[model samples]
Target chain A: MRDASETEKAVRLYAGTVYGIALSHTGSKADADDVFQETFLAFHSSAKVFHDDEHIKAWLIRTAVNMSRRAVCGKHRRAEELDENMPGGRFEFAADEQNDIADAIRALPEKYRAVIWLHYFEDMPVKDIAKALGARESTIRSQLMRGRERLKELLGKDWFEDE
Target chain B: MNKIFEDMKTQAMPDESTVNALIESLPEKPRKRGIRFSHIAAAAAAALSMLTITAGAVSDWTFSFLGDFSSAFGEKTEAYNIVESASYSNSASDMTFELVGVSADVNIFRVMLDIYPPEGTEFTEENKPCMNDNITFDFYLLNAHKGYGASGRFDVLSDTPQKMRVMWTYSCSAGIEDREIEFVAKKMTRTKDENAVNTDGNSIITDNEGSVIKTEEIWYTRIKTGSAPQKVKYEPGGQAIDLDRLPDSDERCRIFVTSAEIGSMSVKLNGLIRGDLVWRDSTFTAVKTDGTPVGLIFSGGSTIGGEPSSGLKDGDIILLFDDIVDPADIASVTINGTELVFK
Candidate 1:
């Protein structure tokens, strides 16, 4: 483990970033809590060497995505078992003015949502996203293209930034 | 689209309590594998604050966990240095969390810590303590050079719960240079063992509780590792014994135990295996004259204590154990695979 102080600083600095990614993936605050805790703790306990803060941030984001997938799968299983007792829907969007965009994004698949979140929200380059998500650069480009196309259909033709 | 996603930034930010909880829970040990940070989602706070620590005699009960670890890995691990100074008890709960055993070879480090649950806590059913739901403790090199790939566990807890003492043993890949290390084992949750058949031959695990435990989900214990203070000491003895024709040797492969250095608390098997072996992933069992086990067998590459060993095509394998015993008492040592009685 690197110095505990450094880990603490990472948590202080990147908790929001990790938390936001988890929220984007799982769309639940409780699930976000678990995923966020897991990502930072994994970062803390991991012996994986990092080149810089950006590398650590990428690792945290990837780990968060992985853990969020697990949480989402588990939530699905529990929901299946509990059946109607569980709330079922797209991403549990907050009551905000951005609900239109949230609703539109929620209509996309998890893959598109992930690429869209990282590409548009986090502004991570396609190469960095590939490294973080363990996907090929070409694959990320395709997914970003498809995610943008899907979003354009939901929002409108003018929704494109460079259209 | 960028403007829309940017507006979602404020919505994605984690609350202050979440961040605060992360900070409060940390400065904790560096347990790597995500067994659910008990401190993060831990229900009750540290229970040791109410309990006062008092001097209690270090009983033979402490060493019971050595048998537990032996049973867990299904190996015969010898023990020598019983770090008695590592033993401590709290008078408040009548609970004792003590470091009872330590077995270390060149690259493997195994430790057993015993916990005597307080009265009224449901720690046992028909006298067999259940497996820990999750056990996490982090040990790091304090004064020495940095090491890598050291995995920790709260694995294999005590099967014998007389006086309601439960033990957990965690083994990590620690090199010889990491002789002096600090253990930061904190939170562990104990629940009924559904799969734990009688590890010790006598007890048949017919605990109907697992069929249904309505009272509590699991007992979460906070071992006062930092608050309780004592220096645990281990001295490796110079006794060396060699064995002939190691087990699981094929025509293409040969495994050798060059020297079995039996120490006060551990026997470090310094040996190398030449060529590929028939079976290298079995267990090392040191059955005593009484037909019980007391040794730990760990597998490693050719690197012993991180130094590259030449002349070995395959790598090195280590047979480790606690409980000091004469070579005569060891009925046999099974290494790699199969059995061989050392004379």
Candidate 2:
């Protein structure tokens, strides 16, 4: 891990961003905390040779993403078992409806929303996203199309119409 | 949808407390694992530091150029005017290193800290630590008794400020120059059988107190000023010993590989294979062949005092010990096609 001062600096630089990534993925405060801590620890342990801010930020994001995904999958498995035997229990969303957007994004297959986030939120073009996600630009374009289409369906016509 | 996305943009930020809490919840600091800088420097600089050190007391000392001289393709070597005293620590560990009286080249990629020990000591005949990009400490020990000698390599070095506290109890009576003791060292690298159940009478691997000798490998390189230095390669014909066959127990096995011509040596264990091998402390230990833990006895050296023994976990495989390694070797450590081989 990094020294306390450097770790503190990293926390200041991207903890929020890391936590945002975790919260968006896991949708649970507790799980998000675990992911945030893990991502920072991973970042601290590595990233010493990180060339600059952009590289450090990307390393954090990648770590946060991986840890959050693992947490989500683990939670999903546990929830599946819990709900497996239960009867007539009401299924509830863990986060607010606004965060359902993230849920919808998570629902898409792995590479799909990766491209979408890079394109929409990260404002990265298809070529760069393609390189980052290890996919062809054409494939990223298609995945983006499919992801947006799926998002539209998940949000329903009301969201778009209201917009 | 646009409004929903915008709302997320506002709420997506992780709270300050969460970040603070996470950072706070982490240990106050990273523990210094394996090989303290004092351990390497004190071996050579022990008497010197204790002696009356004057500014520019000794000049024009020659260091062993064991390893290769020619820089490989795409290798960038950054020369730093090695200072006599610098507070350096591994960015990831709590261990700190300070140097006394030396100058050398530093490559950020390999992070190599070539130590040139003081002149006129023992074991100085061409016994150099291999070159490694992993810069841990920059100290040198020149052997006076052996006419001309250099200090062994230390794996950790950085410009960042760091220090490690050591408590040493010296047991050797042979003075600093001629002490030839076979230090019983536990092999840092282990195989499945080493940690597995042993059924045979000749079981070398066991969890019993004295059955297995565990050890860790630290790579070092020697640098010499003026003209070309030497090159040392632990690979390309280096021997790999399997520790599991020798009967399980805590037994110390000391294997001294001559790194006299090492430019750099790449160190790898089965566990530290996937990523950078961060030392718990800068110390290596040996066990009794019968499974007894033998404390590392520091003799013919200064007593900085010891704190605790540190080491890497059993599952960590050091993938890239130096900045440079063959692609095939890198691929060898990949766990299930993943770049990092944690097992």
Q: Compute the lDDT of residue B223 as modeled in candidate 2.
A: 21
Off by over 4 Å in 2: A79-97, A125-139, A157-163, B1-3, B28-343
lDDT of 2 by residue, B93-125 (tens): 122233443323231111122233233322122
Candidate 1 segments exceeding 4 Å error: A79-97, A154-163, B32-343
List, in order, the clash count of every candidate structure. 20, 110
Q: lDDT at B244 for candidate 1?
A: 42
In model 2, how large is the Cα lDDT of residue B193? 37
Residue-by-residue lDDT tens digits, candidate 1, A39-64:
78777776678878887877787667
Please write out the lDDT profile of model 1 over residues B54-136, one tens digit for every residue: 21223312111111111111112332222323434434333233343333423333343434454465444444333322222
Tell the DockQ for candidate 2.
Answer: 0.09
Model 2 chain A is weakest, by summed lDDT over 10 consecutive residues, at: A84-93
Give the per-residue Cα lDDT of candidate 2 at B332: 24
